[model samples]
Target: MANLIFPSDFEWGAATAAYQIEGAAAEDGKGKSIWDTFTHQKGNILNNDTGDIACDHYHRYQEDIALMKEIGLDTYRFSISWPRVLPAGKGKVNQKGIDFYKRLVNQLLEAGIKPAATLYHWDLPEQLQLKGGWENRDTIYYFQEYAELMYSELGDLVPRWITHNEPFVVSMVGNLFGEHAPGYQDYNKALQVAHNLLVSHGLAVDSFRESGIKGEIGITLNLNHVYAKTDSKEDQQAKDYCDAFNNRWFLDPVFKAKYPTKLLALYQDKFGGFEIETGDMEIISREIDFLGINYYSRAVVEYAEDELLKHKTIKPEQAIYTAMNWEVYPDGLRDLLIRLNKEYTDKEIFITENGAAFADQLAADGQVHDQPRVDYLREHFKAAYQAIEAGVPLAGYYVWSLLDNFEWAFGYSKRFGIIHVDYQNQQQRTLKDSAKMFKQVIADNGLTD
Candidate 1:
């Protein structure tokens, strides 16, 4: 293969969530988040692991920022812990929490790296969860307040802001499937939660505008291309439904300003309707600066009469799989990007989260030789470059993480970072082979095979 070239202005960065990395669960006046409460429940998370001290990023953000600089990152995307900023979820502000983020942003700026801050990454304050969480319409107002506070405090320092990360996962995984924090298994509630999350996104964007902040704001969505298992009509129908549920369910409202009618009809019988309040769609459709896409793999769907969505995912036998059991399909990224550029709004797109989790190990040389990850990233970068050449307005790409932190329900079992973090040995950080390759890619503004 020839060298893969990227735009000179293409942004290179790494991303991490607050709860997944900033493990100061109970320090500096930080209140407990739903994850803190959820992980405390027995048998909730794998290996009974919690993020109490995951990466200790709360105390070592400077060191982490230094590592990011060493990796030649142009930007660093991280989430702000809602509970940390507002201990009770609203009203009084936590000055200590505010100071921490301010310090982190300043350090990144001093290091010549741009800061991209995500307002909410599913770490809703436990108190807010007690008040019905995202399902409760009131949470939207709380989110707006939180967003405004952050913007007022660090809006000038951070150039890029993401309102929410993967609202579909927050709804389906956390609410419907009961796999994440504030777990519940009610379809009706899940639909409501999904709506509320979108509403909060719009509200946050509105707040950003009202603040006169000179920065870009958008929401990050986890999207996948859905493919039919066969040419049969049933399989095609399954693919259509799965695409709507996984991608359009969130995409349409933001870009098209309305929920996909087919999905609405499919769920109407169970819940009567989406219960979309008047003017909710208008708020949800507020124009934004850009769109953040988190692509992983394509979904191969086959018709399944017994499944609620009438779809079943089937992994190809010959395909490579990630530690998360996702197929390693780089073409899916190109397809998804082109589809988004053509079907959705022609807004700027950023690959806010991409990278695979693999079982990485530290060799005797005190280095992590994660070749699989390096290959995964290279293929995906090539895919992204193909999309760019094909006319997608992809502005940047941020790898999934900067360090291997807590992997939510899977705990710390999955490693998705180019840089390895030894959780046992005082959170020792080591740059894996992938990190060195990424540094070269960043420096060259492309991959030189």
Candidate 2:
């Protein structure tokens, strides 16, 4: 198993989002986020699961940090709750909400674990959505204000910060495609949200600099190394659509400051443009210090006339699938890293999230045998190392999660954590196999000898 050693300076961390982990949906005067309303709607969430209590990380954060210490994690990347802090999206600051994060960050620092903070993870304040969500331009300004507030408070302690997580899924998939919260089903509207999110990202980035914040700033994107299901002309077009859907939609605007030509054709005639504010790209394209990437699996595209999305989607393939039914294509990891290096060419990269979910069950002895997840981590870690060998500047790898929290629409059912959570008693601990493997890997610093 030990083939390629990780760089001695490589970072080893784990990730978690706000809504997915920090439950207490209505505690301490926290405002409702889009996800709060979405889960309330009939059929919006599986088993009508909501993050009302989640892992209760809000209350059990100390216990969670203890678990991280047990597993020997170096860093813990988590997101801040936007609505929870600014109830109406930007008027009054909730000291209570701010206090929650202060405690979490201090605990991590005390534990000798680096804290990586993501500004937004799609838990937009419902008040903002009511005022038109990402479709409205004002949200960007509001987000800048929120980022400034966060940096003013915690920038001294937390050294790493991420602006937003995967606009492709939240703005396009959630709002545009009507699959997630603040749900709407208009392609043009989705573009508006996507553009606005980037605008907000730039504003936040600038806010970080103007405030003289310390440490690094970046964004987390869910990039899919997509491929055409076949060589036919139609299939190629399908793949092209997939590219627009997955990679180009976010990357083109962020890196090149231009929308993908094909993607523009699909919406420019309908919606004007999102990141059109002057001097915004100067911030968006600013020399960032690092990049965080969340890679789950490969997505194949074949022609499909869907009702909402209306192009193509993942097709049947003979690859192993995750519990979420995503195909496990290790090469896609290496491919994406190479492309990112070629594209950005200016920032360091971190595999912020790379983990698989399977139907895991606690055994009679209270341990879960997760060989699939072990194989996934091993292979992708090597893929990351391959990217490093190819000069990708790949710096670290963080498993998708430290604990299995709420999986949004899928709720608590989908487990992606190295540590399992017993929701009943709010007990948290680590799995035997994955924890053991991770400890040795961290101790060795790399799989290679």
Candidate 3:
């Protein structure tokens, strides 16, 4: 029996990014993306693995969509590859690329599934990277142009559009930490990139509204509930700074139209200040219809002397961790939803990405008994149900992935999909226990025992 039932109208879905799964890197006149370049370089990805033929989703999307239909996904959230559509990242539209997505959207519709499309998912066109990418203000307008083009091409079909996904990872991980594509290790450059990403998001929203598209537009941010490791004032300050750095820095600009004053002063004192031109804040704070949040795990922070942010996340001892070394904290999802409702906008929130990477092995019987992943999703779903009961207006939930594909810099080393992918065996797919569990969750519109 299942007691925690979601609202009858609650949306259920699975999300996937094109670059991560759609392997047709050079097919259909697609230009190279930063990932294509990054993965090809020496010592960048594990085993130097590239997504050259990842799951072959570009050719196998129909098969994938059939699986989605079987799982009863009410919606399919996918990202459009920037280079795939606009090979040069601007001008010279790739009709074949556009046609691919059109076919994808049409199939989802035929399957009775809504298409929620994301414009950018960290796959900056290689040509755009050559022009300084997000750090360059010109890139903002280029993104707007791409968004408008997509709107004109597929706007009527996609009722939900996400402007950008995880700007924090794009700016911080890719720039500040040098962990992802176009890897840069400069603090000021990262801040500039962050600012430009927000500006571009606003411009896209403005364009969507101008096009009179019958749809809702929003940005998806990877957020986590932050906590202090101890009751000490130093730890509390560290927690606040970490929260500001990860959450408020992006949230405030989108919702409040300004950066957090405390952290803004600190950044200004350290690295000059984020470039803010006239009317930039006004545009950045444009009203959006919903907020998409990607919650994986909570961060626990403690004071650290001689650190840039004066804080560092610390792992709790003896805590359960995912294959990605992330602490599994389902309560964080509940807490984050409640906090967003209390402090951020009143718009509906969607768990745009939520799932765990586990060490999965396919058995001789062509089955994957991934009970841990099923357990992980169950707890997270319970937390989501709790958030809704608390009046958080949580409208939907999209599992982080519908298939196992490239895991970025980690290459194909990690598995986050509920469906097991046999990369060595023709990219064959088999539903894990977790996938079966999720199917029931969708069918029941809630968790089950």
Against the reference, the lDDT scores of all candidates come to 0.94, 0.83, 0.94
lDDT of 3: 0.94
**Candidate 3 segments exceeding 4 Å error:** none
Clashing pairs in 2: 4-447, 4-448, 5-447, 5-448, 6-446
Estimate candidate 1's alpha-carbon lDDT, on a 0 to 1 scale. 0.94
**lDDT per residue (tens digit) for residues 1-449 in model 3:** 45789999999999999889999999989999999999999998999999899889999999999999999999999999999999999999999999999999999999999999999999999999999999999999999999999999999999999999999999999999998998889999999999999999999999999999999999999999999999999999999999999999999999999998999999999999878999999899999999999999999999998887889999999899999999999999999999999999889999999999999999788799988899899999999999999999999999989998899999899999978889989989998888889999999999766
lDDT per residue as tens, model 1, 1-449: 88888888899999999999999899999999999999999899999999999899999999999999999999999999999999999988999999999999999999999999999999999999998998889999999999989999999999999999999999999999999988899899999999999999999998899899898999999999999999999999999999999999999999888998888987997678667888899999999999999999999999999987889999899899999999999999999999999988698999999999999999999999998999999999999999999999999999988999999999999999888999988899999999999999999899886
In terms of lDDT, the poorest run of 10 residues in model 3 is 1-10
TM-score of candidate 1 versus the correct structure, residues matched by position: 0.99
- On lDDT, the leading prediction is 3
For all predicted structures, in order, the TM-scores are 0.99, 0.94, 0.99
What candidate 2 gets wrong by more than 4 Å, as runs, is 232-234, 270-283, 303-311, 314-316
The residue pairs in collision within model 1 are none
